[model samples]
Target: MTTEIGFVFAVLGITIALFISDKLRMDLVALMVVAVLAVSGIVTPAEAVSGFGNPTVVMIAALFVVGEGLFRTGVAAAAGNWLLKVGGGSEVRLLCFLLPVVALLSAFMSSTGAVALLIPVVLSMARRSGMQPSKLMMPLAFAALIGGMLTLIGTPPNIVVSGALKEAGLEPFGFFEFTPIGAAILLVGAVYLITLGRRLLPARTSEQQTDHCDVPGLMASYGVSGQLHKLVVQPLSPLKHQTVVEAALRSEHRVTLVGIRRSGTLLSSILPVLANTRLEVRDELWVYGQENDIERLCLSHRLTHYGSPAKEISRMGREFGVAEVMLPPGTPLQGQSIKEGAFRQRYGLSVIGLRRRCEPLDTDYRETRMEGGDTLLLAGSWERIRALEGRRDLVLLQTPAELGEIPVHGSRAPLALLVLAAMLVCMTAGWLPALTTVLLAALAMILTGCVSLPEALRSLNATSLILIAGMLPLALAMEKSGALAFVVEHLVSWLGGASPLLLSTGLFLLTSLLSQFISNTATTVLIAPIALTAAQLLGVNPEPLMMTVAIAASTAFATPIASPVNTLVLAPGNYRFSDFARVGIPLQLLALAITLVMTPILFPF
Candidate 1:
């Protein structure tokens, strides 16, 4: 082999090692690969950076904004609400509502976001319905991974492979072209999870359960329940202008001030009440009080009952609620103190409590440096809480059961729905370029105030964008250094005599295995070109083989490390690695069977 090809192969090995080691982020590993390639002269610097400008990259970024619009405007949460309503109290019935909607939504947005939005819902389902969180968590993660197979934009791998086809001068897969096989796989998975797969999942104790958590339990443990209320100070109120302590709120009103929201400011404008924080006429007070005393105090003092009572937490969840958000490893929040981060103004949530190593920190977490695995208890408008789904910096650990009952931006849901519909119609009917259609929809979402510019910007996933752009260089390096041809020739030599179905199965197995250990997007980028080359050698259509690779890359079910979706559930479900393998292997094998059987018929190899 030529030195250039040798260098390419060496870099490939190192990249794989880095991915398997889990010592660094995948996106960072990709950048390392790009730097190595550029320094080694495998690809020119211009060629290395060309991926940033690629239509696929641009489209993926645009898609994030569109998905964020849906999320920010509560389109996704609305779907979750529907699932809850339809799911009722049965685990089996919940799965029926859950798997399909999750798959449908993931077909359009980020699978991680789809799963994140539903994680709390699933947990709530577990609490209310007496089902093991284990049974529901795995099913939810698996369904989301499978959901990525349903549309061209369903997952990064789908987009990568489609881009590969386009690069080969073939028409890219159409929007919804993946629906048949993907929907079929989802159907198979649903049946498996409901029947045999449910049995395969272990009935492990949930972390929430083991930790003695629930809305009531948390309220009791924290010693802040019926005590929580919202009160608005009237202009002529005797308490106005008095410092919280000076006002004798504890002695007279029998209330303790917790937080204050000023009128004519955003929800983020809330200020925590301290000993010297003076109350204003229009200030809304978050206080702790006895129900009878609070009612009497408000009536006598002319204070408006601005907040929902603790017992009415569910009824009030639409306007406000509490949740625990943990900073998982790699969260950007690490190293920044809560106050320094200005997290409240940025995220519109107040830190009501902070816990480290399962122990509560001092009441003042303001100056505490946030670290990975530290959990923060947040209280705010449910809409703001729902918006937190887009923040990769936080893993929502224990949202109250009431959170699921809350509707977000209900008034704007219809407009968001219309924008989503328009985008889908344009893509489905070929009324505009797919990329243009998505961009327009995203723009419409902003112009119509469905999602603000900052919210749109916040929704852009830098790791995904950078990962795709960085790995795109590998495709260029492989092609330019004769490495792709070398690999494809050997692959053809080994399987040249096999039937197309066998070849397809082999390809599927290869892609699925790699995906189990690394980013599927990266796997697709490296393998898709080879699939196209192998199809050329076999004298068959490349579409089937390429499609097989795309579908297989999404079968990241067999390992906890396979996909973020899987990892996100590991701690929450109290799962062992064996749990993933036991439940995921069968699903992977089943997906492989379906892909091998269906690809040829769909694409006609």
Candidate 2:
């Protein structure tokens, strides 16, 4: 190997080592690769950063916005709900319904997002059916991974491999090129999971199974039952006709106004308690405070105290809800009390209760200093609670089922669906480039109010995007420095004169093994060029080899850390590391066997 080839290999080794160690963030490691490549003259500075402008990067980013539009408009959640209704309470029936639906959804959106959105729904199903979450969680994750095999835009690996084809001056894979093989895998994998795999799932339960609590249960756990009271703003009352800020409820009366009920001529609507929400006569106010403080406020403002509004609180699910949010380690909110942070004014959610280490704090939690690992129960409109899912400072643990039942943009679902369909049709017909079609769909989503611009922006996973962009330069460096040829030559020599099937098997095994430890997208980026080179050297079809590599990269099933989707179900499923191996190893092998047999049939060498 030449000196430049040796250096590029060194950079590749270090990147793999860092990814396997799990000490530093993947994106950080990717950035390090870019810096080293640029500094070593393996790639020009402009080429190193050109990944940010790559059509693959832009297309993936646009896909995120499109997925967010679907999520915000309840397109995905509706499908999940449909599964519950059709599957009923039987474990077998549920798997049959869940695996295909989740896979199909994953084919269109992010696997991680599909899994995250359905986790609570699946948990609810398990709870209602009296089945163990482990029995279903692993299948949910594995199916999502398999679903990515079904479409070109299903996952990053698919996009990466397709981009590889385009970069090599070949016609890229069609939009549905992966469907036959992907569909076959999903069908076979679903059967395996339902039978043999289902028998291997753990039956253990964990705290996550009971993490979500109903409104009454949450209040009872937080010991806030006695503190919540309802009062009427009587005519001529000092608080009537005044905004919440003008009345100074929290500052002067030391009581938190949770929400206000305005009884209109046709119906009663619950208004989120904002600083500018003006109070009118006969408005029912849900307030939280000590009994003495509440009494003082009621007497001073000429309000009629009506004791606790338990019924109203239960009915608050229509417009209001509660969610549990935890402050992750190193959160910026650390060291500041809720009051000091202006929690309500900043987030538009009231911090009603706090828990440290799973134990509820019965003290004045509002005055308690925020700390990492602290779990706070927030009460507000469902819209505000939903927004917390995107915040970096706090981890949104659970929102009540009511949150899913009510879509924030339910009216825009049709528009979102229409845009998605049009984009797919255009791409499949080659009416526009894939990236152009995706960009137009994302733009339509924003213009039709399916998802706002800020929401679309927030939906983009910067880590994945940066990791892909930063690592693209390394792929370029490998190709530019002859490192890719070196690796391919060695691989071919190792399988000298062997059939193309043997070569594909080797590529599949290597890709699958590496994917279990690192980001699948990164793994695909590094392996795709080598696969392409090997195919060219052998004078065989590169399409089958590329398909094999893409499928193998998604076999991230044998470990919890394999994929974010797997990690998502870990605690909820009460799974041990071995539980994954027990089910995932067999599944990975099954996928390999299926891919090898089917690839040649679909795209002959």
Candidate 3:
């Protein structure tokens, strides 16, 4: 090998080591590869950054925005809810219904997002059916991975391989070229998971059961269930016509005014409890405090207490919700009390309950000093709670199920669907490039109010986009320095005269093995060119080989760290590392056999 080739391989080795070690962020490692290649003269400065402008990168980014539109407009959640209605409480029936629906959604959006959108729904299903979450979590994750094979935009690997073809001056794979092979694998994989794989999954209940609680369960866990009371302001009450702040209920009476219901309005017309919200005669007030304190407040103010309004509290949850949040390590709020930090003013949320080390704090928790790992139960509008999701200082541990049922833009679902269909139709008709088509669809989603512009921007996964962009230069460096050719030549020689099926088997094993450790997208970026080059050297069609690389990269099973989707289900599924291997290894092998037998027939090597 030449000096440049040797140096390129060294960089590749270190990158893989960093990825496997999981010590540094994958995107950071990718950036290191770009910097080294540029400084070492392996690729030009412009070429080093060329990946950001690649059609593949742009198309993938646009796909994120489109997917977000579906999420925001309730298109994906609707499908998940539909699964519940059809599957009911039968584990077998739920599995049969869930696999296809999740796969179909993953075929169009990010597989990770598809799994996230359905996790709570599945958990609800498991709770209602009295089945262990483990019975369904692994299947949910596996089907999502398999679903990516259905469309070119389903996963990054598919787009990367297609982009490789285009870069080689070949016609790219069609939009649905992967559909036939993918459908067969999904059907077979679904059958395996529903049968033998189901038997392999663990039945242990989740250790962190507190992490998935509904509104009632959350209230009960926080010891707030019996503290809620409804009070009607009598005409002679001193508190009538006094604003919430003027009443000083929390400061003097040790009670919180949760909300106020006007005397002559529908139950749904309850008004939010702001500091300036004034009380009037016969107005029903939702108060939370100790029974004695609430009684004293009622007697002193001449208010009539109506006991706990369980039904009204349920109705209030439609407009206001509760969530659990924790202060992550190194948070700025570490040393200050909630009152001192103006928590309500800052986040528009009230800390109604606090827990330290899994034990509930005293009711007078407002003055308690904040510490890392302290959990707080916050009450606020669902919008405010959702806004806390991506903040650095606070980690949102659990959101009530009510949040999922209320879509931010539910009325725009039909518009979002129409835009998605148009984009797909335009791409299949070859009337526009895939990138242009995707960009137009994303823009339509924003313009039509299916998703706002800021939401679309936030939907773009920065780490994923940066990782793909930074790693593209390394692939270019490998080809430019003849490193790829050198490796491809040896790879062919090592398996000399092997039949196409045997060759594909070798490729599948290597790709799938590497994917278990590395980001599948990065694995594909490095392996696809080699697959293409080898096919050229052997004088055969490269389509089947390219398809092999794409399919293999998605076999990120057998480990919790294999894919984000796997890790997502880990805690909720109550799974161990071995649990994945027990199920994933066999599934990976099954996928391998199917891909080898099917790709050649469909793509014609």
The backbone clash count of each candidate, in order, is 2, 0, 0
How high a TM-score does candidate 1 get?
Answer: 0.59
Model 1 residue 408 distance off true place after TM-score fit, in angstroms: 8.4
For model 3, residues 1-605, the per-residue Cα lDDT tens digits are: 89999998898778766765667776677788778877898899889888788776687677778877887887765665567668875778889999998899889766865675566567646654557888999999999999999999899999999999999999999989999888988999999999999999988776434346776677777877677788999999999889877887876887876667785452332123366677789988877788999899989999999998766765566567789999888888888876666666678777778788988878564557988999988876777887898887789888875675556998899998899788767765658866788889889999999889998898776665676678678767877898766865676677646767777887888788767754788778888987877787778898998999999999988876567677667666877667888899999998888898889888888
List per-prediction Cα lDDT, in the order shown. Answer: 0.75, 0.79, 0.79
Ranking by TM-score: 3, 1, 2
Give the range of the ten consecutive residues with the poorest summed lDDT in model 1. 264-273
lDDT of 1 by residue, 49-120 (tens): 877887766776676677666666656655555665687667788888888878887787667656655665
What TM-scores do the predictions have?
0.59, 0.58, 0.60
The per-residue C-alpha lDDT of model 2 at residue 460 equals 76
Task: Give the C-alpha miss distance for residue 244 in model 2, angstroms.
Answer: 20
True-structure RMSD for candidate 2: 10.2
Candidate topping TM-score: 3
Candidate 3 lDDT score relative to the true structure: 0.79
